[model samples]
Target: MATYNPIRDMERFADALLEGSTRGPRRMPMDLYRDGDNYLLTADMPGMDPGSVDIDIDGQLLTIRAERTLPKAENVKWITRERTPGSFLRQLNLGQGIDTERITANYDNGVLSVTIPVSERAKPRKVQVSTGAPAGVDSSEVVVSEA
Candidate 1:
């Protein structure tokens, strides 16, 4: 008995045709982690020019974009070629507690790094609690527990 999968067959066909395609855009690999009061994002963009990298924020979406260019080829025999040059794009959701105004980005050694600081209003703080208040105080009372 034989089974057929349309999605799997389509993926295999695409891979065979686009394995060395340099005309379409692709996703850039990235890593994101939290350190202290800020979040650090590292993206791998080997052989990419520093001036081609761009970082922007629209509403709650943070986007990273870049492009790579390859030299034009003439009439010659080709033996081996693997790397494809094209556009790279990545987007992330910046939820609450992000200091968007102070965000920063840097590109060096073919890698892009972005720093996102946490907002002061989202940081944890200590709150004092009181037992009984004066009788003259408001009729409504509230209580808190340190435990």
Candidate 2:
């Protein structure tokens, strides 16, 4: 016989409501930062199957989706099942200056890392300044003044 606890039942109900099993995709925590010429994004997805991870980029939007499915067993009783299994999703708007075609992703040890490279045209570069000398004068005689 199973004992009925209202508090436990309430907790289960709340967990189901917040887990987003049927409401939609659950939000996952992620960290994004710029490293040198590339932007790095790492997301935490422990216990998630690597094959279930999906990443897509559309225009300026970058979306990440993954699923965590529980195993099935016959005649098994779960004790204090707390881990929520469902779809996880996250989207980020990557403005201009990003090399969308060069973007790469990798999943390792339950962490998904994405590398977004900065476009060549958006990189910082120094411009050369030249001083024009008169046609009649020697180019070496020209003096350049710094303001």
Candidate 3:
């Protein structure tokens, strides 16, 4: 005989509910990753106009909202329907180190790509070495430049 845990079952049920609520046509798929000096976010939004999408960053959270109005098909009847149409709202918690003001977004070919530029403070900095012998290198002789 196998033992059943009510707490574990409830947790699994809650997780499934959350996943189901975040799915559907209104809720598009998204992928976020760090690429070089920027954070890239790609979303799959088919049959949606670029102007209908809105992106907002508040504090350390990023929210994407979009709405789509489907055209009515004349003389068409559906026996089974799975596609849903409505407004969508998706939010992501960004790290405190992310620069919100430098974020940029673009929508094309049923896909949306957003690039958030990294701040100077969040980027890695190189440490300069002293070339001079005794009291470090002189200002006039040392030329420091980033690679």
Q: What is the C-alpha RMSD of each candidate to the true structure, in Å?
A: 8.3, 5.2, 10.8
Candidate with the larger TM-score of 1 and 3: 1
Over the full model, what C-alpha lDDT does candidate 1 score relative to the true structure? 0.85
Q: Which ten residues in a row have the lowest lDDT in candidate 3?
A: 19-28
Q: Residue 19 deviation, candidate 2, in Å?
A: 5.5
**lDDT of the candidates, in the order given:** 0.85, 0.90, 0.78
Model 1 error, position 126 (Å): 1.6
Better of 1 and 2 by TM-score: 2
* TM-score: the better of candidates 2 and 3: 2
TM-score, predicted candidate 2 vs. hidden true structure: 0.76
Candidate 2 clash pair list: none
Considering only N, C-alpha and C atoms within 3 Å, which residue pairs clash in candidate 1? Answer: none
Name the lDDT value of residue 64 in candidate 1.
92
Top model by TM-score, which number?
A: 2
Per-residue lDDT of model 3, residues 75-108, tens digit only: 9866533345566768888886678888898999
Assess every candidate by TM-score: 0.75, 0.76, 0.65
Which lDDT tens digits does candidate 2 get at residues 95-134?
A: 9999999999999999999999999999999997767764
Per-candidate clashes, comma-separated = 0, 0, 0
Candidates, ranked, TM-score: 2, 1, 3
